[model samples]
Structures are given as C-alpha cells and as structure tokens.
Target: MSFQHTDSIALSELEGRAPTHSDLESRGITSSKEKDFKEDVKETVADSPVDSDVLIRDGVQRKLGQRHIQMYIAGTIGTGLFLGSGGALHTAGPLGALLAYVIVGTVTYSMICSLGEMTSFAPISGTFPHYAARWVDPALGFAVGWNFWYQSVTSIPTEITAATILLTFWDENINNQKIYTAVICVAVISINIFGVRIFCSTAEFIFSIIKILLIIALLIAGLIIDLGGGPSGERIGFRYWRNPGPFNRAGLVESNIATDQFLAFVQIFVQAAFSFGGMEAIAIAASETESPRRNVAKAIGRVFWRILIFYVFGILMIGMLVAYDDPALLTDTGNAAQSPFVIAMDRAGVKVFPHIINAAVFTSAFSAGNTTLYSSSRILYGLALRGQAPRFLTYCTKKGLPLFAVLISSSFAFLSFMRVSKGSEGVFEWLVNIVTIGSLISWLTINVTFLFFRRGMIAQGIDMRKNVYHNRYQPWLALWGVLWLSMFILVNGYAVFFQWNTTDFLVAYINIPIFAALYFGYKIIMRTKIWKPHEMDLITGIPSIEETELPREPPHTIGGKIAAVLF
Candidate 1:
C-alpha cells in the first residue's frame, strides 16, 4: 500500500536523452546496422521507472549503525571456523589449510571493497543486483537476484542442521535432533518477522558478542596450550604442522605424492571459500543502515582486519594444536567433537572446556541461520518492488515486516528435514557445496558490475575525489577478482575428474548450468541488450542520498575510539 513508484521520474529522465547511433558506436554498443537495438533499450527503460528510493516498509527507518553492522558480520562467521575446518585440516594439512583461507580472505576483501564503493553511491536494497540491471543488463540483474535469494534460502536449513549437530556435542545419545531443528527454525523466523531493528540491534548483537567472546577465549586457551601452560604442561608449538608434514596427499592417493598434495591443496582452497561465505551480510543491510554511506564505508574498511583476527589467527592456533590425521578430525558426527578448537582443548586435558565451546557453537549456528532469513526475505522484497518477482512479496506490515516474503523464505527451513534421512553430515556437505558455488558467482557478478559502474561514472564525468567513500584501485581489483573467480568456478568440480562420481560432479558443477539457463532464458524473453558503457543511469539517486544526515558523529570517547579501531 505504501510503495513508491519510480516510473514517471525514470521515464522522463531517460527519455530526454536517447543515445544517438554515433554515441552507441563510440561506446562499442552496436554494429553500424544495429541502430534499432539502441532505440529498443532507450524506449524500454523510458517506460519503466526503476525504483531509486528506499521503500519504507511499514514505516521502518534507517537505524542500523556501525556496531550493528560489525556484529551482524560476526554472527555470520557461523560454526564453520569451529567445526567445518576439520575437513580442510585433514585434506590440506595445517599449512595448506592456512594458505587456502588466506587466499579466499584476500579475494573476499577486494570484492567487498568494490561493493562498498558502489553501495555508498546508491544505498539501495538488492544493492548489487539492482546495479547489475542498471549498469549491465536486466537479465543479469534478474539472474543474480534470484540466485542470491536461493543461496540465502538454502543456507537457513544448512545452519539448522548444523545447530542440531552442535547439540549432539553435549549428548551424543540424545534422540531429539528434529525437535531442536524445529525450535531453531521457528526462533529465527520469529526474529525476522519482528523486522530489522530488533533483529539487528538486539538479538544479533547479543549472539555476536557471545561468538566474539568464545573466539577470544579459544584463542587465549590455544596460545596457553601451545606454550606448555595447559594441565599437561605440554608445549605443542606447531608439532602437528611438522609431523603430518606440511601437505596431505592429494586425490586420496599415497604413491602419487606431488599430484596428491596439489589436489589436496585445491580441495582445501574450495573449503576455505565455503567457510567465508556469509561475510558479505553487511552489504545486504545497507538499505536499513543509518548514515549508510559513512557507516558502510567504516564497516568495509574494518572487514579485512576482522578476517585476520577471527579467521587467519584462529586457523593458525588450530593448526598448532591438532594434527591433520587426528581421529577427531575424521569424525562424521556433525558435532563439536570434530571441532579443531574443541579437539585442541581436549588434547591438553581441559575436559570441561569442550562443553563450553559446544554451547558457543550452537549460538553461532543459530545466529547465522537467523541472518539468512533476513537477507533472503529482503532480497525477495526488493525484487518484488522492481517487478522482477510476484508483487505480493513487496507487501509490508506496519512494523516494516515483509510478511509474505518472510513466510516464503521461512518455508525453506523445512529443507533441514532432509538430514533426517540423508544423514546430517552428508546433507550438510551437499548444502555447503551449493552455497559455495552460488556465492562465488555472486562475488563474480559484483566485481563485473563494479567495473561497468566505474566506466559509467568516468563517462558521465563524476568526480571521485569529493565522494565520501571510493575505492582507488577499482577496475583493476575487480578485474583480478573476476579472473580469479572464473578459474575457480571452472575447477570447482575437480574431484569428479579423478574418480567420476555422479553425485559429486552434480553437487560441484550444477550451479553453473543453472545460472546459464536463468541468464539466457531471461535475456531471450526480455530481448535485452548488454548495456553500453555511456548509456547506464549512473547518477539517478544522488540528490535524495545527499540529503540524508547522520543522527550524530561516531563515538569520540577513549573506549569508543578503541572500539572504532578494533570493531
């Protein structure tokens, strides 16, 4: 009932300046005989007003701040760092796993930096998905939007399955896994239905603090164990790294030593990619973020350092304490017993710590699952507003809840039931592989979209110096991200080449074909063209965005200053 229509404004703004044939040719948009294509695009956009303003869902205001964004990211860290690292540890050895995480982390940093720059200019919901439509093609936008929504929807069940598994860490003899799963599903859905302020400001903030405290405690305990301060007074000191050797055998082979190690490294590389999947949640929160441009800029700048502390340092400690061949790492119970962090503590004779760590793991899993519902529903609502999805999804309640979208997204939580029959570990890995592939494509789309965005800005003569947030080495960073991600996408199914298992191949490579079908199918139906560089709407929402003000300056007290730096 409260939707803001962009049609009239977009129609007048774009129709006033249809690009001439010469202009199109100069920008490499068309062949000499393809003049009709340019006119088609001009006419199409002129009639459709792309919504440039943030739709006020049920009177919700932008209230999320820097602290909220940081904690949201922290909660998104999930249980992967604690439990899922076992597979990587076994496959790649300590050094190999560490290198894999470092590589993926670097790529993710570059990707989010590019996104921050773009979102600062237009802090819209469906952020990069909207940019894809404007700067590239409508069909690309459609494909990416739905792909991301699907990824988020699937991730909910994955985290629920993980939560159930974490409970098992305390009582392996328990018989109520499904009951636990249902409780988590209902809790997260309820949190999302209450709208952004409660979810981001309270529930997520508290859960993230628990997560941060747990990681810090683990880090200190790990250091103590490595330094001979544990109950056994044993100084582990990278003993595992040296003994199992630096690299595990690749292709699960023993004789083909070099090849086996290389394959194993690749396996670890992909697992690292999966572990870092949800770190981009801050970008999704841009529409609801108070002083979005400034806050998002601050958050993005700090993301890399956070990754270093939580992931790189955490991985380093795990490597020091647990050997790749440890029987604990090989357990498929889908519980915290397999957590390298728990394993490390148990090995040091700290028997009680594992229970504490397992409780924290449950908190991390539930928080991550809660975040997925928010992101998925918001994405669907954004799509509905843009006419890419069923219009009912855009309907919001007085509390700013996208009720229909939330319900639809919550329905996917039932997917966790698959674990009941398929086995929790197997089903969890299935979900992880699919999510990893989808996220990689999403990252690739962000980079390519940013490159086009840069071209349009330069073509329109917008000065970057005066902008509040701008990345300096863009197009290059984007270019490298695209190239690197492309290589990984091609080789994501490398395991199949060695043994040729049908399930493994499908799980690894199915997303590519699915994405292709969505992209081309939409292209054919809409008759859209690859948007030329000079023709993109690069400055549509700047005036309204500029009028927004921060409620107050960031904290200036001594403790606040320290928080500003550390967070």
Candidate 2:
C-alpha cells in the first residue's frame, strides 16, 4: 500500500514549544497521512509527560449515567413533533402523515445505529466530525463540523421563538415576545455553563419526565375519546379516516387524486425530517456519559423502541381521533391551536385539556432549546480542538464546560428579536428556513462516514469481533440509509417544482448549495485527499482509552435493575 505523509506538527508539539517547521523537522516527526494527523496528535498527547490537566480540562468528564443517557434521547420532543405534525396532518391525510413518520423513524434508526457503532469504540467530543476526518478527509471534517455547529446553534433561537409563541396561547395581550425569548435564552445558557451533570443531564431528566408523562396522558386520553368515553359519549374510531378519506388530494396542477395523494405523502416524508432532527443526540453525548462505550451502546439499542412508542404511537393515536379536515387545524394562530393532540381534545369537549397540553408543549420546546445549545457548543469546542475553528473556542472552564463555545452558540438566540420588526418576519423565516435541512445533511454524512470507517477497520486488519459495538447488518443498512437520505435531500422541495416561488425554493433547497460550498471549498483550499483505507488511523486513541478502567456495574437493587433495563 502507498503512503502519504505530512509535516504537520500535532497539537502535542504546540504544548512543548513554539511550533516551527524547522523544530518539527529537527525531531524527524512526520505523520503518515494528512487525514490521520488528529490521531497522531491524540497519541502524542496521551504519551507525553506534560500535565494531563491541560487535556482533561479541555474535555468534559463522563459524569452522565444510564438515566442521563435516556433523558438525552427523549429531550428533543419539541415543536417538531408537537406543532409541526399539524402541518403534515393538514397537507397529507391522517394515514399519510402516520406513514411519513414511520418511514422517517426507520431511516433515523439506521442513522443512529451507524453513529453508535463508530462512537462506542472512540467516545470523543468531536463525534462525527472527527470520524469524517479519520474515515474520509480533513477538509470534509472541517465542513461537516461547521455545518453541524451552525445547524445546532441556529436551532436554539428557533425553539425559543416557538416557546414564546406557545406562551401567548394563555394571554394574547402579552406583546413583549423579546422578554420571554431573552429570559429563556439566558436560563438555558446558565444551565449549560454550570456543567453537564448539573444542567444537561439533570434538566433533561426532569424535562423528559415531564414530556413522557404528558405524552402518555395524552395517548390514554386519545384512546378513551376514540372509544366513546368523552363527555358526549361519541366514538370516533377511524371515522375521520373514512370521511375526509385516508389520502389527501394535494397538488398544484389538480392531477389524478391517487397521484396527488402520493405527492402529498412524499411532501410529508420530507417534512418528517425536522421531527426526528436531534434524535441522534445520544451519540453526541458519548464523551460525557459514564461508561460511554457501554451506556451509549445500550441507549442506542433502546432509544428507537422508546421513540416508536412515544412518537409513532402517539401519531397513530392522533390519526384515529383527529380528522384531517378539522377547521381548528387550519389556523395560523401559532400556539397549541396548531397541535392536533390539543385540537382533538378541544373538539371532543375535553375542557381544561388544552392548558395542560400547552404547558407540556412549552416545556418540550424549552428542553429542545437547552439541548441545542449544549450540542452546538460542544461541536464548536470539538472543531476548535481539531484546528477547524478559532483557538479560543476550545477554552473550557475548571468545571469542564466549554464556556467560550457556549457564549458563541447562544449569541444567535438573539435573532428572535426580528419578530419585533413589522415587515421582517419574512426575513426571519428565510433565516429559519436555511437551517432545517441541516439535520438531514448531518444524517447523510454520518452514514457515509460510517461506511468509510467500516472499510478502514477491515483494511487495517482489525477484527470485527473485538469491536465494542457493531450494527446488526454489515454495510447494507448504512448503504440504504445513505441512499434514502440522499433521495430525501434532493427531492425535499418537490412542491416548488410544481409551482415555483423563489422564497419557497430557497427555503427548501438553499442548504444544498451552502453545504457544497463548504465541502468543496475546504477540500480545494487544503488540497486534501479522499482518505485511503490503508491510511486510516484505526488504533491511535484506542490504546489510551482502553487503558482507563470502565465504570463498575450498576447496583443490584430493584430500582437499579429497572433503571438498567429501561435506560
């Protein structure tokens, strides 16, 4: 096998002395491949006699346990599922919307599984960006890291905006949305700055409990209403499905009814992307979780089942109880008014239900914004550590919080102030539109990176049996995931093609060109190669990571056993 070498002085050398080219040459230090420099730096740092505190402080401690991991998985049940699904139900019929979510869930599970396989072996803060560099190219890593960071950072303001909107459901007289937005942003930032255990894990655990309980309550209520147990004793079991019909006739040209329904189904498929956006956050928490290799692997295996029960089943129940043509679902009011679950209860004459559901929805949005800040900040810190971002971003507090990165990520939350401008709502919407596609892009990259990573392992003569975690199906699942995600990305904006609107087109497809610019631009600027399998760094950080002892098993008490199984 041919080899490529770089004169790059890894970060370890930066700590030793001024990183001069001549100084590096004097030591005869050379990296075998440009793509593998990160591994070389990690190995050098791990073996160096320099203070371990330097490296330790830059990275977070693994204070999160199984309960925390479970909370992180459920933390993002926000506007995407609560309010966004209303659009799906409106555009597509009940069955079409349900099918859309089910399909996305399948693809999301594949993406999560791929991420889990890579992270279990090397639980680092850099996550997929590091994997992209290791398995693909350094330039690709730079692009993916920044793209994901922006996606995560921008989402905080989106959630904050959604939360403020939800709050107004109680009293429309409240005119100052900025006050609520600013306060929520500040609160989320403070929680993150306090350290992961105190905030990310604890807040998520509490919020997830709130979300899960509310969802369970909502589902039980829906079932009872469907069974003729409401105040009017009216059974609504699939009645709406038969009346407004199971399929929606949605198209610009007014074509065949069946064809239009199919088109609506496709549109819903794309819309479902946002609902499952942050579901892979479990993999992102790899570095912060206690016994990450074991706990993350466990979470990865179990989170999908939980998602199916909470999200998919909830959607199914909504379909059974709520008609697609319900007048309340057509509102642009922007609150619990748009939630099908709330609308169904209101239609069934379930007084006082909307208030309870609205409160739960508000909590979901807040928790989602909190997780977004945490994820985005860590991505920035990881990028800085890998030399893809500014050096100052890697600065962490004594408590292991990436304070600088947190500040930068939260800065975007102020964008919510655009709501005050009379005519700037369109501008704000445009900015918001640019970010929604990022999650799909991230999913595509994860699958591609996983493919290369698997090949690298085989090429380097590593034994698959020794892996800490591996997906059930060998490359096929990842291949299908990549193909499906790519298809979804390309055709996500199909509605624009039927009748083009410049803004709608831009909103649907703009992220593609932006991602292309970043990827090819970085590749051209750096002159990096698509990494060769033999050149991959399969074993660099593993030795040091394996040297540390794994956490002891959980206690054998009944509560511990239940936690062990559920988490």
| Top TM-score prediction, candidate number | 2
How well does candidate 2 match the true structure in TM-score terms?
0.90
Candidate 2 least-lDDT 10 residues:
48-57
Q: Whole-model lDDT for model 2 versus the true structure?
A: 0.78
Runs in model 2 lying further than 4 Å from the true structure: 1-57, 543-549
lDDT of 1 by residue, 132-235 (tens): 88788888989989999998899889888889888876666556877887888888888988878889888999999999999899999999999999999999
Alpha carbon lDDT of each predicted model? 0.78, 0.78
Once model 2 is optimally superposed onto the true structure by TM-score, how far is the C-alpha of residue 270 displaced, in angstroms?
2.0
Evaluated at residue 539, the lDDT of candidate 1 is 42
Per-residue lDDT of candidate 2, residues 254-321 (tens digit): 75777888888888877887888887788778777777887777788886787798779988888888
TM-score: model 1 vs. ground truth: 0.88
